[model samples]
Target: MFCGIVAGEVRAFRVTDEPDGVAFLDTRPVFKGHVLVVPRAHLVTLADLPPESITGYFGLVRRLAVAVESGLGAGGTFVAMNNRVSQSVPHLHTHVVPRTKGDGLRGFFWPRTRYADDPDATSYAERIRSALAADPA
Candidate 1:
């Protein structure tokens, strides 16, 4: 689905394009200037990507993070990716989101408002911790 974006055949609000990957403004973004860096070749997950391709692909992601932060005057950037679990597209892409202090983002992809208070938050954390402790792997 996203290979078209890398080939320039798919029109998007482009940020930068390099041999390694393509960086473009996400059509559905959490904020303005949000960019998705996609590898030129179609790789379903990060594990599917060749090890040598890592630096080059991620280099563009790093640069776009800076651009999203400085160009948009954001306090910082949130860089992330979803593997097979939550991968929206079958292609690998990195998300670089512009962030401000009170943007209301909390856990990885969870909205801050999804939780209530400290007790509510503690309950969630405890469950995860218990699961981690029980895991044999």
Candidate 2:
């Protein structure tokens, strides 16, 4: 889906198309002016992104953050990315959501669920710590 959009094979409201990346409107937007920025190359996650491309990739994100607010007359913008966990697309895409005062959009789509107790929280944290320890990268 993202590949088609980036290649112009799919229809999407285009924003900016540069060597760094491409920007376009999200089909299902949080707000009217929600846009998505994606790399031209097929990169699945931030860890897959080359170190040399980091600055360029985020530069485009920074530009869109400003443009969303100025162009849409929004109070602010919510820039987010989901890696493997909540990623809707296998291809990497950054969501640039326009924000305004009292828009009634609550933070985090999921319900506010808490751990059973501190022990449960500690166990979850340990799992992440062990994963990071094993990963040399």
Candidate 3:
């Protein structure tokens, strides 16, 4: 799944200028502004990611978390990941889901949603990308 996105074989609404990873909207989103940041390399889990790459990879995650909040006007963000046990895809991808007060989202068992169409998802991608570009840190 992620391999296809990294290879441009899959159609993903992508956020440009990702430093050490590829940024794109998640197909099943916890919220409207949910984004998935995945390393360019095919690392199956955090254990597979090399030590030297950790900082850069997490730097991108931090930026995306900020971008998701500011871009979507969310109160905050829910940034997390699943390892080998609950891993849906065999890729080390971090999920950055936008959060708002009283949005009814609770814990890891919250429901997910799909964008109405590509245009809708593209709007989110554009917002996050613009925010990411504007972010100097």
Q: Identify the leading candidate in terms of TM-score.
A: 3
Indicate the residue-level lDDT of 116 in model 1: 46
Instruction: Please list all clashing residue pairs in model 1, or write none if there are none.
Output: none
Residues 1-137 of candidate 3 have per-residue lDDT tens digits of 99899888999899853549998999899888899999999999999999999999999999999999889999999989999988899999999999999999987786989999989999999999989989949
| Candidate closer to the true structure by lDDT (higher is better), 1 or 3 | 3
Query: Against the true structure, what is each candidate's TM-score?
Result: 0.76, 0.78, 0.96
Candidate 1 — which residues are off by over 4 angstroms?
A: 109-137
Candidate 2 C-alpha lDDT tens digits along 1-137: 98898999997667767788987766666766667899999999989989999999898888777767766567998899999998989989898877889887787772223445545444433432333234313
Whole-model alpha-carbon lDDT for candidate 1:
0.69
| Model 1 alpha-carbon miss at residue 5, Å | 1.4
> 69 in model 2: Cα distance from truth in Å?
0.4
Please report, in order, the local distance difference test score of every candidate based on alpha carbons.
0.69, 0.74, 0.90
For 23-71, candidate 1 gives per-residue lDDT tens digits of 7666666765566788988888999889999988877677676666656
Off by over 4 Å in 3: 17-19
How does residue 56 of candidate 1 score in lDDT?
86
Q: How well does candidate 2 match the true structure in TM-score terms?
A: 0.78
